[model samples]
Target: MSDEIAVPPRQDNQQWLRWIQAQYGGPACIRRGKRLHDALAQLEQSLARFRQPGHDDDWLAMVRIRLGQLHALAGDWSKLEPLLDADSLRIVQQLYTDLQPQLRLPPAPDPRPDVLRTALQELQEAIAFFNRRWLRHLQSLDLSFYERLIADYNRYYLLEKECLLQSPRLARLGFQPLPSLTWQSLLGRFPLLPMPRLRNETSEH
Candidate 1:
């Protein structure tokens, strides 16, 4: 069924896969707590493909997400700022959305359970990897939105884990700690907020 997708005349399919893998490796390197430039270069190649028209949406989505990860890795606020556009932000939102149990544990008797698990794990690992790199960038941006984003992500992950824990069919799926960050820690590292607090201090008195 996938023979065609498996082999494209332009070789775009395979090359896209290779690029995604390279981007993935780049982020893994950052998570390993090593220098980030080499990985950044690999990610740049992945993103370069996006400049060409006619790229697949799924592939473009990956490139956008990978660029976000790369920006976070470099701690280049100026560059990272542009990469965190609505499309890239949506990718971040979907990372937690995909983890939803009803979505993952779909009624049994379905074939390819292993494939589903693999897909879920790959995304989870990507989010985890991104989170670690993102926290470093967040530390510098001092954005309240960053705090809210991380907290919401952590909450959703915990909720999803609990859902998995109660699934009799999937209970054997084991577990992993929820991703998180603290306000105190956030404050300690990045004392200034990226946004200014707005108050409706109107003269009513």
Candidate 2:
């Protein structure tokens, strides 16, 4: 029998999600550890073929995040722990510490400008630090990990900027106003935005 597996020419987020469900979902008794490993290897190959600089990183990030969730489901922390480098891990830990409260909130129809500004500043600082430390080694590291980091920062920046521009206090600050965004538009723009979902929560979903 051929060992080769056929994959789609262009893999999208939904495809990735489906692949994950097929591998990890269903009755617990039927789940196989080897299947999870094989699926992750296939995912890496797909990522190598499909990744496009500046565009596909977010997709890659979601795939990797899903892989981590699968590993946890398989009780294979050893596989997931090494997916990110030391610096990336540190940065992620810091981000969780700083952004956990805001991330846990339910969707807000009207968010405070001061709160948004604070979140924006934190993201800006995190992005600057990430770029300074990891920019040079980007290709060597898991692109998806970096993608997740960048996506999180950028999502907050966009969300906060939108809120701040609507503030009366900042009206005369002379910053050019971005076009107004609907809540759906804002959420759609950053589909990989970090959420409060735990690892088990993702696996179950």
In model 1, which regions exceed 4 Å deviation?
A: 1-111, 142-205
Model 1 over residues 100-182: C-alpha lDDT tens digits?
A: 21222223331243433333234344444444444564445433543454454434544543352455446334434333445
Mind giving the per-residue lDDT tens digits that candidate 2 earns over 75-139? 42232233334443444444444333222223332234344334333443434443333333333
lDDT value, residue 44 of candidate 2: 53
TM-score of 1: 0.21
Clash counts per candidate, in order, are 0, 0
| Alpha-carbon shift of residue 28 in model 2 (angstroms) | 48
Local lDDT at 179 for model 2: 41
Candidates' C-alpha lDDT: 0.38, 0.38
